[model samples]
Target chain A: MEFVVFIIAGLLAIIGALGLIGFKNPVHSALSLVLSLFAVAVLFLNQDAQFLAAVQVIVYAGAIVVLFLFVIMLLGVDQAEDLSVEPIAGQRPIALAIGAGVLALSVLFISVAADGGATGQQSVTAEKVDSITGTAQSATAALGDNQTDGTETIPNIEQLGRTLFTDYVFAFEVTALLLTIAVVGAVMLARKPKGELAPLPVIPGRSGTTDETEELEDA
Target chain B: MELTSTWYLVLAAILFALGATGLLVRRNPLIMFMCVELMLNAVNLTFVTFGNDLNDLGGEISVFFVLVVAAAEVVIGLAIIVAIMRRRNEATADDLSALRG
Candidate 1:
């Protein structure tokens, strides 16, 4: 079951990613990205990171991609980009070569990695592994008792919440502050510049800034 | 065929590579931003895979922070893009050399 699920989800993810880059239209790319995000969320479930899977769908597919579409529409720049217009000769080939090199190096590193390459102390959430009960035996561990027989391990969300609120609580508080700052920054950035407007800079290829300058000056 | 953490790590690597290439090759600023989101998602997958392998909640918790930061980044980035595009109807990444100091 794990193999089957992994193969399907991984394939979908790859297809979505390819489509994201292959599509000429930004909207189609955004939609393909949604498909990829959903596939990744499925992968999260396979790894028992259920909480992340939910957030992956809700925040990424639901919120972030939607925001992308929103911006594309609002800007009215949804027209198809001219992919063949490569002002720099051979830039695509160089970029593709670099990407392939990165993939080859990472794969070589992982295939050589001992025990799946994850190294570090598995602390906080599952501190002690009780040999008898075959489950975590930590004080702060948030193991869920969904099954009366105690066969149920720690639920992913509960443990994540516990860890977030405890050992990494300060960092958690800081994330809240970061979000607030981001909101304020966005509002400031999107707002139009007011009063005594310097004339818009002259674009190299485009002609006519007088009309726009007069319009801004009037505002 | 065993579905190991290595599978996920490999998948993430491919995703990251694709995103990097797309960001590099695509002149459209919007598409480049989407590529950035793709890379972020790839990292999140790697983080979850590691968390599962290590049998720790820290990995999952770190993913939460990543999601929050990604959200904030996208917000600010899109706002800047909107601001820039408002000045001109169409502007590609190459055209955005205003910070050429």
Candidate 2:
């Protein structure tokens, strides 16, 4: 049953991602992206990364995509019109070749990795514990002693929070600072000036003479 | 072959490729933004898969940060897009080449 859920979530994510690219309308694309992000969060939940899943929903699906929609609406840039002339003449071939190359490389990597049988159930659990604790030695030791069954043990949220707050505190604080800066910058950029100001006169010394000369000439 | 988590990951990869292709091929800024989001979600899927495989909570925490950053990006990105549209009167990415050297 759990495996079925994972399959469904993965399918949803893939479909949503495809829709994001397939749709021409920005709103539709954003909606598709939202769906994809949500599906990913579900996948995280299935992985027993409950905190991550919740954050994924709250941040990516809820805030980020909504911001994209807001921008689209504000700009009124979603009109169905082709903005650029097709084939700027020189760049299309290069772009296509590069894209194809990337795709080929990705496929090759995936195939090679898959052939190595890297998807066994045991290694994943061990990797997860090591990542969370930031020490492979302890986790490996624990795994050696606790080898009761083949089923992987899922770590609890409390352990996760403790690890994050303790070992990764500085990184978390830095992230917070970065977020604060982003918020401030966004607000400043979004705010419009009340009105345009007159241009300041250049050549301060000549300004008065030039104005007097102009008046005398007109008289 | 039997259906496994790896199969799901492969599907995610295919989806990611589709999204990347769309971004590369499409000229629409909105569509491009959506495609970028699709790619980000694909990465998220990989994180979750690895997380599940390892049975650890760190993946979840990282995903949380990704989500938060994504949200902040959307808000600011939209504002900038709107500003650009108001100035240009057209939202097509072709007109956004003012900075192109």
Candidate 3:
């Protein structure tokens, strides 16, 4: 079952990714990206990351891609792009070669490394800990997880909430600040310029357009 | 065959490569941004897979942060794009040189 799920989701993700790049229309690309996002979300669930899977769908597929489509329409840039006009000769082939190189390098690294390079994070609270070395010390215990002594697993959302509020509370608060800054920046950027775009003064002797515009306003 | 974390990692690498190629090849700013999202999602997948393999909560928590950051980034980026697009309806990534001065 797990293998079947992985294969299907993985294939869907690759297809969506290809559609995102292959489509000439930005809207179509955005829509295809939605497909890819959904597939990733499914994979998230397969990993038992239930909360993240929901966020992946809600935030990524629901919000981000929608924002892309909204912008595509609002800017009136939905028309099919003329992809044939490649000003730089051989840029596509070169970029494709670089991409293939990157893929090859990562695949080689993954294949050569033992256990896919995972550190086998230590679940210190567990009764019989694995002999594998890990960086975490009392991390699982520190999170107030009830699963330490009980056979029952702590709910995914509860575990995440505990971690966010306890261990990384400061970082969580910082995200609020980051979000506020982003909102302000977006509003400022989206706002229209207050006045006309006057041409720069031709000669320095004129003392500049700033003075000219002010004088005109005064008049 | 059992599904291992390595399978997911390899798939993510493929997704990341595709995104990189699109980012390099596509001249449209919006399309480039979409490609960037693709790469970000690929990283998110890798993080989740590792988290599962390690039986760690840190992976999902890190993904939470990433999602927040991605959201913030998109907001600012789209606003800038909108600002630029309003100035000239048919602006491509290359035309951004107008701001160089």
Candidate 4:
């Protein structure tokens, strides 16, 4: 059952990503990205990272994509792009080749590493801990047997919350500071001068015959 | 067939590749930004999968940090895009070459 769900979600994610890259219209691409992000959230749920999955949906699909749409509509930049031109010559073929190479290498590494029996993650971690500490029984005991099945048997959200407040609180506060700086910087960069949107300056000497009318208004 | 951690890792790698290809092929700044977001999502999936596979909380915890950084990136990136679009009639990445000065 979980395998079926993973396959469906993975397909949805890949298809949505393809649409995102292939679509000429910015709005269509943005919508495609939303679909892809949502599918990823489903994959996260399947993996039992419940808090991260919910955060993925709320923050990514909810806030970030909405911001994309808001900027798109606000700037009125939804016009279809010209797909005919390659602004940077020879960029396309090289990029595709590199991308393909990367994909092939990654797939090869993963398959080769998993060639041994699928003993699952718990035993692997336990073995590493045992080797480092030179105590197999105690290391396995420390890691606990609850997760031997690879399904999140513990309440992940509770464990995550505890970890955040206890072990990772400083990093969490730093992230908050970074967000505040981003907000301030964005506002500063996007703000226009008081009269920036007013008419362009008309100088008679610099103006051509076509702009004579506007120059007269300036005088 | 039974799904394994390797399967998830492979899926993420493919998605990341697609995103990189899109980033290189696409000229529109907005679309390029979308590609970057796609790549980030792929990385997030990798982190979560590794975390789950290890039965460790560290992987998902790192994902939380990644999400925060991604959010900040989106906020700043879109603002930059909007500012550039306001100055020019079109928002293609090629047009911004004046900044190559």
Say which candidate scores most in DockQ. Answer: 1
lDDT: worst 10-residue window of model 4 chain A: A200-209
lDDT of each: 0.82, 0.64, 0.83, 0.81
Report the lDDT tens digits of candidate 3 across residue range A82-159: 887886899999999999999999988887753434454333322133234232324455545464554455467777
* TM-score, structure 3 vs. true: 0.85
DockQ of each candidate's interface versus the true one? 0.62, 0.41, 0.58, 0.59
Residue-level lDDT of model 3, residues B17-87, one tens digit each, is 99999999999999999999999999999999877776767788889999999999999999999887876
Q: After superposition on all CA atoms, how large is the RMSD of candidate 2? A: 8.2
> Model 2 - which docking category?
acceptable
Each prediction's number of clashing residue pairs: 0, 6, 0, 0
Give the per-residue lDDT digits (tens) of candidate 4, residues B56-92: 6678888999999999999999888877677565646
Cα-based lDDT at residue A148, candidate 1: 30
Worst lDDT window (10 residues) for model 1 chain A?
Answer: A131-140
The interface RMSD value for candidate 4 stands at 5.1
DockQ of 1: 0.62
Clash pairs, candidate 1, are: none
TM per candidate? 0.85, 0.75, 0.85, 0.84
Q: Give the Cα-based TM-score of candidate 1 against the true structure.
A: 0.85
Model 2 bad stretches (over 4 Å): A81-103, A118-133, A136-155, A196-219, B1-3, B55-57
User: Which stretches of model 4 miss by more than 4 angstroms?
Assistant: A116-122, A126-154, A195-219
Clashes of 1: 0
Write one digit per residue (lDDT tens) for candidate 2, span B1-20: 35555665775676677677
Candidate ordering by lDDT (highest first): 3, 1, 4, 2
Instruction: Using lDDT, give the best candidate's number.
Output: 3
